[model samples]
Target: MQFIDTHAHLDVEEFAEDLPEVIIRAKEAGVAKIFLPAVDLPSVSTVLQVCRDYPNYTFPMIGLQPEEVKGDYQEVLKKMKKILDASFAQSSPFIAIGEVGLDFYWSREFEQEQLIVFEEMVKWAVEYQLPLMIHCRKAQNELLHILKKYKHDLVGGVFHCFTGNQNEAAEYLKFDNFVLGIGGVLTFKSSHLREDLPACVPLERIVLETDSPYMAPTPHRGKRNESAFVANVLRQLAASYQVSEEIVASITNQNVARIFGISV
Candidate 1:
């Protein structure tokens, strides 16, 4: 039962000392690939280094995370685009433009800034013909509005760390080019995803993730998450669908491969 950890931050400082063991554990646990999403300009290099160290097992995506979008976002965006352009020009392009979107959970001080940067990133996705890896917090409505505006320009993407309701999930599915990225949130006792996901989303429209060094599954909750724990998400998703874990893994692996243009 091979799988992909669709949205993990292996380059985060939390894993600095033990990233090797983390990848070993993930490989041992049947994780065929770990998708690394850049959270800011510096992360572009960090993710690149991690992927370089594990060329066959790790892939990188470039973008500034919403929380990091500040008054200097224009500069940040330029730096990211420069890296992406150089990579493409050198025949070494990233697989996606991601870990990008809007997040108002903390503050709306940068709302407009985030929106502009998001639109730019969306254009980057289309320009590169790469899928997007989106992150959203309390700004789903605003984010959805922006997505609708550029629906024709999108190449599809995953709504990573999804925390939406049935109706919200339904709205995202309308894009036809998107998928819900299910992660440790699904294993939380209080998560709405437990009910909404199985009831509202078809298994094929889902992909597995761990959001590593962040939302580790239960028993490992509040602890550092790593790629291997995506198996926990796979287990619960199977329960939600009343199927075996292997079936869940197979379906999700296909979804990841199809969406990100990678094979396990």
Candidate 2:
């Protein structure tokens, strides 16, 4: 039942006091690795620090989240570029360019800015030959439109925390090297993923994630989430696909490896 949490925020304050315990519980629950996605400039350091502490057990990604884009985004990215270059030069590069994409969930005030930032991220991913960990919401059409240009150049990546319909799923899958990131949303009683997903998304093109410190599954619905809960996501996905949990874990782990070039 080994697993990989392809997306999570273990560096956040919620896990500050007991991150070690959280990692222990995740390992106990068979989560062999966790990928940490940076949301903003500060998180870059935090995510790196956590990955440094855990070494091979956890990996770090670099990118600016769309939701966090602001007036100073250009300056922030400039500073981050220096850090990214330094890491690359040192031979300790981040696993992916991630937590980056279009998110019009809250407001469209930064719509243009998000587009600019996302294009730059796409460029970064292509230039670095690293995969992307996209976080798209309410702007899939636009995101896909932009992504179409770079489809051939992208190495591979995951559509992190995917909760879209079948049509949207199909569109994202058009990118040969991309995979949909399945998470707690699939387990919600109200979610159509149980019915909708299996038909469109192939098990081999899917990966498990908790998106933790958020989106905990059914039994832990309203509570804080962690990598350990990816087991719950794995359970629901198995039932949805009518396969054994071991099958789900194996395929998803392979998907993670293919996309991010990591192993348990």
Predicted model with the maximum lDDT: 2
Q: Candidates' TM-scores?
A: 0.98, 0.99
lDDT for model 1, on a 0 to 1 scale? 0.90
Whole-model lDDT per candidate:
0.90, 0.93
Candidate 2: C-alpha RMSD to true structure equals 0.7
Model 2, 88-188: lDDT tens digits are: 99996599999999999989998999999999999999999999999998999899888999999999999999898999999999998799999999999
Reference-based lDDT, residue 18, model 2: 96
- Model 2 segments more than 4 A misplaced: none
lDDT of 1 by residue, 178-254 (tens): 99999998999999888888898999999999988888899799888999999899999999889999999888888
RMSD of 1: 0.9
